[model samples]
Target: MSVTVIRPADRAAWLDARRQDVTASVAAAVLNVHPYTSQYQLWAEKTGRLSPDGEATDAMMRGVYIEPVGVAMLRDQKPEWAVEYHADNAYYRDEKIRIGATPDAFAVDPGREGRGNVQIKSASESAFKDYWIDPDTKQVIPPTWIALQAITEARLTGCDWACVALVVITWRGTLRLYVIDIPLIERHWVAIKTGVAEFWRVVDAGEHPPIDWEKDGSTVLDVYRDSYTDVRDLSDDAALDVIIRRYKEAKELESSGKKLADTLKPQIIFALGNSAAGKTASYDIRASTQIRASYVASESQSRVLRIKPRRDHDVDASRF
Candidate 1:
């Protein structure tokens, strides 16, 4: 099959025709890239499954939630070449080299005289950071990998330039865009092509190839795993106890039930009350339920129960 060269006008029309479908396709492609796939696959393996499909699978739910959110965030950034939803480009070699990349959205800067093909990416904040920073050196990884992917798509369509636009949507719904230039992209094309060749070699040898990121000086899996482990380790029982108490208190408030403030562990109580009152009184009141009451007698001889409430719940009430 002859390679279909998509001109800027044609590309624009094609994207306008099928935007949503193309965006989903792009999101799926990104998910297949190094760190994303590795993390998901590891999660699946840990849960004793090859695929995240079951309704009960947390992995499946997480993937489902993230992809659409990422896509929406990308669309919201509204790149100049936002193509039709689901625009698909297929390139086939008559003998063998049949591979395709369906970019979520493709745009060209009319102001730049349609010089480059821009690929738009909507990513979770974590994924966005992982793509940039080198896992080993903690430096910014060259944008070559991104540029290479864009170039491959450009080559498939016989375009001269490739641009990658990444819109990172943070958990708080903030969007940030990163653009890749053509010179940087061209510099990395040869390495990406060589990496692809090595991948084919591994396939022919009946072995899965190690990811290019490992050789590219960064691995998403290592970074994600290391960060995850660090967080997990820091959340020890003592740390978690504080969180649990807070959660319980919040839940009780939501339900309008009597707050089980007393059931909160001593450590949490001490932390909450350490600022107010003397430590001795706070400790004495927390250690036992013996209410410390200060009495005031008016000139008329009426007694007032001056109860010192727990630090967090300072409800001052007088019983006559």
Candidate 2:
């Protein structure tokens, strides 16, 4: 497939281009490998139900800020590999798949056959430990999402190979750099297309992807950002009942004084309104908001009872 190269006039145009296509950054989300983005969120963005411009997270900002340093390392390590960093912002796209990627650089290795895609990334020490390292084997590996991003770049640019130039900043404030080549793009192409095709099919059908209950908590809240003030009884929803039961259990754990979760008890109680008490075997859990002299409820309401995947920090060994 012939790839279209577009050097946008400005950042707005670059972002506008991304709105229509499933850009490489979030490509792995469709396959459920992206750590941050969920499949439903990607569907929402592509279908125009949600804004495509997601806020630049700290991790994302660090990647942009430290990319040059990683590229500098890439130059230092492989002097023979001729690489060009596009400062003007060139987007390589394949219209057939409606997929595109703007890689950090394009390279031509004197040792290799053809041009290669270079993806410069910056990860925190913990992220490097978690995603890029095979724990038991201790072998360095590019993350699935990162690999997919590079593959999309290679496919669009007609590159024979893709490379991830990574820089990791440790908690102790040291930098680590590595050059990882993503081999066998042709082998992965079919799987990528399959996932992407199914994603677009759901989007075209105006249907949400299956709810990834563990990862889509924040996404669920965001989907109802502009929800009406009118109350609707969801008593018939069996799924909601299960989710609510799980939420109550989490709240119970929080109230148990295990100290793993912070005090969101008041907030949960306030969300429940007049009836905000539940009894367990050990104790009675009750929540009531104090009224101030000038009493007025805020127009905006906070969504409670979100289910999220537990992070390493959120886990407590003592409880076990």
Candidate 3:
């Protein structure tokens, strides 16, 4: 059986149209490439669950913040002749090759100044930490993936120069931009292409390739874990007892069905004070909640002391 491979130029044009459609849409959109299509098919085969579009849609919607930044960077930086490319599908010699990559955002740099691609990622503070590390030396690494993707798009499009622009937006409303040069990416082209070829070979042989982060676990999950410290210093049995107590309390509250605000009364206290000759003054203290007691004894006198829970240090609002 003969196989048909679509010319790269034709593929590029089709991909450009699809990306434009996505940009124009009001809702988040997704455009899947080749190996993903094949992988989805295999997943369906194994799991007997045929709905891949829903999964893809959910994933795409989760990262919609990156789209606007990517689009803006492409329009501002790239050339007029450059077009977006996506790999839609691919097949073996006995089947047609169908692969697509919409280059997230891409454009040719007019006057051959610089062709550029943008890989916009909305990263939390902790996720950005990994990008700042050196991947090889495990030191502070830069955004190499963005550069590699940009160079791949440049080579695929035959552009003179390529740049990878990363727009990382944090949850706290801060945006960080990172740019990578094309030549640095070009140096790794051979390795990248070889890896792709090997990947396809595995796919063509009808074996299910592992998921992108299956080995190490999901990157998003890792980020979520990194956001907070573990409060699990207590043993499992003790933790379960606490959890069970909370559950029982919740159940009792649910049964009563009382308004939450009505059930709990909050008290507020106020104090007025003035400085007098810069002398320190003492006030009466009360014991409440779990607290530690201390004793101070001198040869002439003895005193009993109680310590309250240490509050978080007061912070100046101006720093933020």
- Against the true structure, whose lDDT is highest? 2
lDDT measured at residue 105 in model 3 versus the true structure, 0 to 100? 52
Instruction: Give the Cα lDDT of each candidate.
Output: 0.40, 0.68, 0.37
lDDT of 3 at 208: 42
TM-score per candidate, chains pooled:
0.38, 0.74, 0.39
- Residues 32-140 of candidate 3: C-alpha lDDT, one tens digit per residue: 2322333323332233232212223643664554667655655555445454534332211212222223445555555566555544445555776665556677643
Candidate 2 lDDT by residue in tens digits, 10-107:
87898887777788888898778898888887876676655346567886677777978888888898999898886667887878888888878988
Stretches > 4 Å off in candidate 2: 51-55, 229-320
Please write out the lDDT profile of model 1 over residues 1-320, one tens digit for every residue. Answer: 24433323454554433321212122222234443434223222323323222233664455434444444554556455443334344221212232344543445555555445556655677876777667888754435445555666665555556555555678897767656555535544454444444444544465442333223112222221111111112122344334344435554586553344322332232232222212222121222222234557322211111122336532222310
Q: Which stretches of candidate 3 lie over 4 Å from their true place?
A: 1-51, 55-59, 73-99, 107-114, 133-145, 184-187, 207-320
